[model samples]
Target: MTNYDFVIELFIRVDDAMKNMPKHSQAKLYPSELVTLGLLYAIKGVGERAFFRWADRDLRPLFPGLPERTRFFRLLATHQDWTERFLAEPTVLGIIDSYGIELLHPVREREKTLVREREKTLVREREKTLAPRIATKGKSNYRWIMGAKYGFLLNQLGLIVDWASSWIGTRPRKAITIPSSNP
Candidate 1:
């Protein structure tokens, strides 16, 4: 099964766990749907704007019944108490390795001119605001200096149980960690 399929299953499991929990009735998106969509966005390594742009065409199949991005993000932000349970779970032996998911502009693409420009603008803005002040020198063969890092905390099974992004620095700052676990 694709990673999205597994994540869909994970969301169902989390929803089942929260079945008896107290929640507001006015909430537009379910906790499971919010987590699922966020994971999907992270997995696709695209921003919400991009996701929404292609949601009808590309992501609808994966989501089946996806909600609007505003609703999805609102649920995620306003209902953290419910979602935090997922991130705190460790699906593995106690440690999960993290990686960076740097979204780069395609070196050979002419379509989606507006999207590319917006992504580039955002990246440049992030570079200005988020890049590390201190610089370290290294001369390895793959001497890379990523300005920021973004990736999921997946188990050995390749399931994303968490997601994090960090600024590149001697003392890297932790990014927001998304919940990706069970109760």
Candidate 2:
């Protein structure tokens, strides 16, 4: 189907879903308009700035009420749940999978030279700011690495049913103890 056709279909579906839901407080853009832009964002898979630029140039005619970049993003975030419900398909069986997303190279974590200095500096800065909440040392494939793990649940049709990511849990250190000769 053409892009305009897809946008129209998506807008209609989301608009129908929104009919049963409460209206947004003081929203200038309709839910249909927001969902259309959201579908465009997902299909384009481009960065926010690029998406905004393209939309302004090409999509303004179709979505004349499209807001500024930041405002558009805010609207998306505010209605994220509605968007998810609108996009998700019905499924009976789902396959779950997970993978580690390494933030730093395992070898680089041990390196103490200028070659690794920049990465180290960045990690240090991130730790100071986002620490255990976002990044942590965790095991992946029996190897310790600094990173986060992402999990996904997919339906038989290979569509994602759900997804999440979080800081990896740190492994517990083995305690050292001396043998007691008296015992």
What TM-score, computed on C-alpha atoms, does each candidate reach? 0.45, 0.65
lDDT of 2 by residue, 1-183 (tens): 986687778778778777766546887677777877887798899999999998899878878878889999998988876665643453666677778888887677556346446688776776687644545667877888778777766767987666666767743232212223362
The models' CA-based lDDT, in order, is 0.56, 0.72
lDDT of candidate 2 at residue 2, scale 0 to 100: 81
Which model scores highest in TM-score?
Answer: 2
The digit string of per-residue lDDT tens for model 1 on 9-114 reads: 8678867766766544965455566666665666678877787776657656666656677766666567555555665444544344544432332332334446
Query: How many pairs of residues in model 2 come into backbone collision?
Result: 0
